[model samples]
Structure formats: C-alpha cells, structure tokens
Target: MQKSITNQNQENIKGIIFMVSAVLILPFSDSIAKWLSSSYTTIQIAWLRFLIQAIILIILSFSLKYKITGFHKKFILVSIYISSSIVFLFWGLKYLPLANNIALFFIEPLVLTLLSVLILKEKLQKNHIIAVIIGLIGTLIIIRPNWSAYGMASIFPIVSAIFYALYLITLRQVSTKTNSKSLQFYIGVISTILLSVIIVVCELLNIDSFGFKQIDFNDWWLILLLGVITTIVQLLVSKAFFYSKASSLASFQYLEIISASILGWLIFKHIPDMLTIIGAIIVISSGLYLISHERKNSKT
Candidate 1:
C-alpha cells in the first residue's frame, strides 16, 4: 500500500512538472506567432505551422515504428477544432496584446466545465456554476468590450477559447484509443490540409488578411521554431494529462497567462491595466478553487 501511494505521488509530481513545462513552452510559440503576424497572413502561418509539425511528426513516427492507422472521425474533428483555435488565436494576436489574448484564452477551463455539463452530461455542482460565472467576469474585465482598441479582435480569443475547449473535450475521448504521436501526426496533417484550403479560398476571394505571401529567410526560422516548439508542448501536455486527472491539471494552465504577460512586457512593452490585473487574480483564484473543489468531491 505504501509503495502504491508512493508511485501515485511520483506520477502526480511528474504530471505537474510536465504541465508546467508545456505551459511555459507554449507562450514562446505564441510570442513567435505574434511576432510573425506582422509579416504573414494568419492562414499562411497556420498552414506552415501545421505543415512543419506534420512533417516532423511523420518522421518521428517512422523512426519510432508506429504505424499510421486508418481514418478516425474523432481525430479529424479534433484537428478541425484545434486548427480553428490556432487560426483564431493568431488572428487575435495580430491586433491584440499577448497578455490580453492569453487572458481571454484562459477562460478555456471554464468553457470546458460548461461543455462537460452539456455534452458529457456531468452533474454540475454549485461551486462549478459559481466558478464559471467568476471566470466569465474575469474575461470581461480584460476585454472591457466597449473601451478596448482592438474592437472585434477582442472577440477572436474568446472564439479561440471555445474551439480549444472543444478540442480538449474531443481529445479526452480520442486519447484513450490512439497513441499520442499518431494522434498528433494525424491532427497535424488534417489541420495543414484545412489551412491550405482556407488559404486557397481566401486568395480566390482576395481577402488581404488571409492571402498568402512569400516567406522570408528570417520568417522561415521563426515558423520552424513555432512548429517544433508547439509539437513538443503538445506532447508534454498529453503526457501530463495521462499522468494526472484533468481537474488536478487545470490550475497549472494559468502559468501560461503569467508567461505570456512576461513575454508581452519584454517584447512589446505591454502591461495589463488595473482592471485586467484584478480580473486575472479573480480568474486564477476561481479556477484554483474550482479544481480544488472537484478534487475534494472526487476524494469523497
């Protein structure tokens, strides 16, 4: 019994470490995307990001001797949702501050809770309801809908969060049946194809923001780093989730917000306003409480 408890504790520690590493690494990719957004269209960036990821993942799969499997609807759906989330996030980053974008995206956990209740038919506790409300309030504070300069761009991250939440939900179902590398490879391939289609459509329609442009040498390096780092982060996060309960993993996600804030300050000299800061605190607190509450209920 003691040995079993010790192994469980070790797994929990490993999960926390992996999760923290993933969140830290993820901000770097977003920062690079924000930097590159000035030069490349969102669709173009998304296309390259997924394309490179797919290539690397294919190589990794072959090296590791993991056979590519048949088509699964869940994998395709997860890809679509994640691809949409990335496109929306990069679009928002083009206009919004990194901190603002991260703050808005932080509502994903709350969104996931609601999704669980609705789609998973999970019973919602009173604390979960309260946490969702508080989380929304925090997002609103950061957005400040009427006053923010970004205007409609502010809504993009919220949309990104929604898609990401759905991705997480879909991932939960698919992760059990698929190997992580194969799953990632398939999603990368599907997303690359989807972004390619979007880019072709945008070019045909002459949509300036979505139109493709020739990549420069500097941008090539950045895009490569974006894909590689993002792939690593995804693997780390997948391992983290495998080792820990979703509820326990939820709180550590806020680390991305902190890392984003630092990156924004260093790279862009952007700072959150008083209201945004207050909202972040509230959101973090509420999310932590929600996770702890869930953990307690599970224990009982």
Candidate 2:
C-alpha cells in the first residue's frame, strides 16, 4: 500500500510539472502568432503552423520508428475542432491583448465541465452550475472594457475555447486508445489537410485573410518556432494528463497568465487592465473550484 501510494504521488508531481510547463510554453506560440499576424493573415499563419507541425511529426515518426496508426474518423473531427480553436485564437490575438486573450480563453475548463454533463451524461451538480455562471460573469467583466477597443474580436478567444473544449471531449474519448505521439501526429496531419483545403477555398473566394502571400525569412523562422512550440506543448500536456489526475493540475493552468502577461508587456507592450485581471482571477478561481469539487465527488 505504501509503495502504491508513493508511486501515485510521484505520478501526481510529474503531472503537475508537465501541465504547468505546457501552459507556460503555450503562450509563447500565441505571442509569436500575434507578432506574425502583422504581416500574415490569420489563416495563413494557422496553415503554416500546422504545416510545419505535420512535417516535424512526420520526420519524427520516421526517425523514431513510431508506428503512429490512430486514424480513426473521430480524429478528423478532432482536427476540425482543434483547427478552428487555433484559428480563432490567432484571430483573437490579432486584435486583443495577449494576456487578455489567454485569460478569456481560460473559460475552457468550465466549458468542458458543462460539456461533460451534457454529452458524457455526467450529473450536473449545483456547484457546476454555479461555476459556469461565475465563469460567464468573469468573461463579461473582461470583455466590457475591451469591447470599445476590440469589439467583437474580444470574443474570438471564447469561441476558440468552445471549440477547444469540444476538441478535448473528442480527444478524451480517443486518448486512451492510442499513443499520445501518434494521436498528435494524426491531428497534425488532418489539421494540415483541413486547413490547407480551407485556405485554398478562401483564396478562391478572394478572401483577403486566406491569401497565399509571400513571406520573408523572419516569418519563416517564427513559423518554425510556432510549430516547435505547438508540438512541445501538446506533448507536455499529454504527459501531464497521463501522469496526473487532471483535477490536481487544474490550478497550475493559471500560470499561463503570468507568462502571457510577461510576453505581452515585453513583446507587444500590451497589458491587461485591472478589470481584465479581476475577471481572469474570478474565472480561474471558479474553474479551480469546479474541478476540485468534481474531484472530491469522484473520490466520495
């Protein structure tokens, strides 16, 4: 019994480390996207991000001999949802401050809880309902100030969060059936294909944002860095979920705001206002409350 407890504790620690690392590193990619969005359309940046991801994963698969074979039909849907999540996030970054964008996106865990209740047939406790309400209120607090400057663009991260929550649901279903590396590889492949098609269609329709414009080496390097960051973040998150009960790591996600705020200030000279900071605190608190309650309920 002691040995088992020790092993579980070790796993929990590992999960926390991985999850925190993943969330912290994730903001760097968003910062890069914000940097590049000045010169590229959101769609183009999204495509190149995944294109490079697919390429790296392909090379890694071949070199490591990782026979990645999780090509289930659901992965295609996962691709679509995750693709939308990222594209929407990129769109948000173009208009909103990085810290604010990431803070608003933190609503995802609440969204995920609600989704679990609806789709997974989990019973919705009163606390879950309360959390969602508080989460939405927090979202509004942040949006209220940004509305004048960013208007509808401020909500893009929420849209991104919703699709991302959906992606998480589908991902939860398939995650245990295959290796994380394989799942990530297929997601890259499918997202690359799906985004490519969308970009082509948008280009044909003469959509300005999806046009294939020329980019210099600077853009190329940022895209490369974005791809690497995406890959690393996903792997770290996967390891986190694998090693730890997600509930234990829920609070660590808030660390992202720190990194994002730092990046925003340093790279873009943007900072979240007091209202946005309060809103983020509320949302993060509610999410932590909801997840912790859920974990307690599960234990009981």
Candidate 3:
C-alpha cells in the first residue's frame, strides 16, 4: 500500500510539472509565431515551422528506435487532421487579432468534448455541457465583433477552432490505436505534402510572390529557431499529456490565456481590456472546476 501510494504521488508530481512546463512554453511559441507572422505569410511560416519539425521528428524517432509502421486507417485520419488544421490555422491568423485568435482557438476543447460523445461514444456529462457554455460565452466576449476591424477576421478563428477540434478528436482516436511516434510521423508527412501542394499552387497562381520570395539571413535564422521551438514545444506538450490525466492537463490549458494576456502586454504592448480579462477569468475558473469535478468522478 505504501509503495503504491508513493508511486502515485510521484506520478502526480511529475505530471503537474510536465503540464506546467508545457503550458508555459506554448505562449512563448505563440509569441514567436506571431513575430514570424509579421515577416512571412502565415501559411508560409506555418509550413516552414512544420517542415522543420518534421525533419527533427524523423531524426528523433529513428534515434529513439521507435518502429516505423506502414500506413493504416489511423494514418489517414492523422493526415486529414494535420492538413485541415494547418490550412485553417494559417488562414485564420491572417485575419484575427492574436489574443482573439487564441481565444477562439480555445473553443477546441469544447468541440473536442462534444465530438467525443458522438464519435468515441463518451458520455456527455453535465460538466461537459457547462464547459461548452462557458467557452461559448468567453468566445463571444473576446470577439465583440466590429465591422471595421473584425468583419471576416472574427469568422476565421471560429472556423479554425472547428477544424482544430476535429483534429484533436481524430488525433485522440488515432492515438489509442497507434504509437505516438507513428502518429507524429504520419502527421508530419501529411502536412509536408499538403504545404508543398499549397506552395506549388501559390507558384502557379502567382498569388503574392511573397510565399516564394527570398528571405534575408536574419529571417532565415529566426525560421530555423522557429522550427526547433515548434518541435520542442510539441514534445513538451506530449509529455505533459502522457504523464497526466487528460482532464487535469485540460484545465491547465486556460493557463495559455493568462500567459498570452501577460505576454501581449509586456512584449507586444497589446493589453486585454476589462471585458477580456473578466471573460478569461470566467473561462478559466469554469474550465478548471469542470476538469477537477470530472477527475473526482472518475476516481469514484
């Protein structure tokens, strides 16, 4: 009994540490992406970020001696999720404000929770319903859409959120049936292919000449660092989820809002208004409560 308790405590500590590390790193990653988005088209930046991560993922997978599996059903689902998410995210960032964009992206957890009921056949608990409400209200508060600055920009992030939710739901299902390394590999492969297609089409249409235009030496270094950060943050996120209960980790997700809010003020000089601050607190409290309650029920 003592040994079991000790092991459990150890796991909990490790999980909390991993989860916090992941949560903190994500905002920094977003800040970096936001910086890069200034110089490159969002799509080009997204593509390059993943392209570099893909190469690193491949190298690490081989070095770690994870098995390279042949393609399967889950691989296809993974591919679809990755491609859709990358496309939608790139397009969304082109329109939305960074904080608003991320707030909309937070809609993913609610969507994922609902989808799990339909697809994974998970129960639609009361907590889940409440979470959806809180998330929706939070989204509405953040948007407060205006025609001049917000018109279509408001729509893009919501669409991105939906696609992201789909991606998360599908990824969860696929993860259960396959190794994480394999799932990661296939996602990278699919995204690289998808982005390559977008790059080719951009060439054919001569959309902006920006996508294929030459980047300076400094930008090149930033892009390289962008790739490295992308890969590392992903690993940290995976570790967090792997070590902790999903519900526990899910609650910590709201930490990104707090982080983004802080970073936006300090780094970008963009501060959340009173409404945003209130909405963030509401969202965070509701999400944390729901997650903790769910965890308690699971234990019982």
Report every candidate's CA lDDT: 0.79, 0.78, 0.65
Best by lDDT: 1
After superposition, which runs of candidate 2 have C-alpha atoms over 4 Å from their true positions? 1-13, 121-146, 243-251, 272-300
Q: Give the per-residue lDDT digits (tens) of candidate 2, residues 15-73.
A: 66787688879999999999999899898888888888788888998999888774788
Residue 110 lDDT in candidate 3: 68
The parts of candidate 1 lying over 4 Å away from their true place are 1-17, 122-143, 243-248, 273-278, 281-300
- lDDT winner, 1 or 3: 1
Q: Which candidate is the best by TM-score?
A: 1
Question: For model 1, what is the alpha-carbon lDDT of residue 6?
Answer: 65
Model 3 misplaced stretches (Cα beyond 4 Å): 1-24, 233-252
Number of clashing residue pairs, candidate 3: 0
Error of 1 at 208 (Å): 2.9
Ranking of models by TM-score: 1, 2, 3
The residue-level lDDT of candidate 2 at 214 comes to 85
Quote each prediction's TM-score: 0.84, 0.83, 0.82
Candidate 1: pairs in clash: none
- lDDT for each residue of candidate 1 in 118-160, tens digit (9 for 90 to 100): 7756566677567667766776786666645777887888899
Residue 106, candidate 2: C-alpha displacement in angstroms:
2.0
lDDT of 2 at 58: 82
Q: Give one digit per residue, the lDDT tens place, for model 3 in 154-243.
A: 666667667766665565555555555666666677777777788889878888633555566778877888778656765665554454
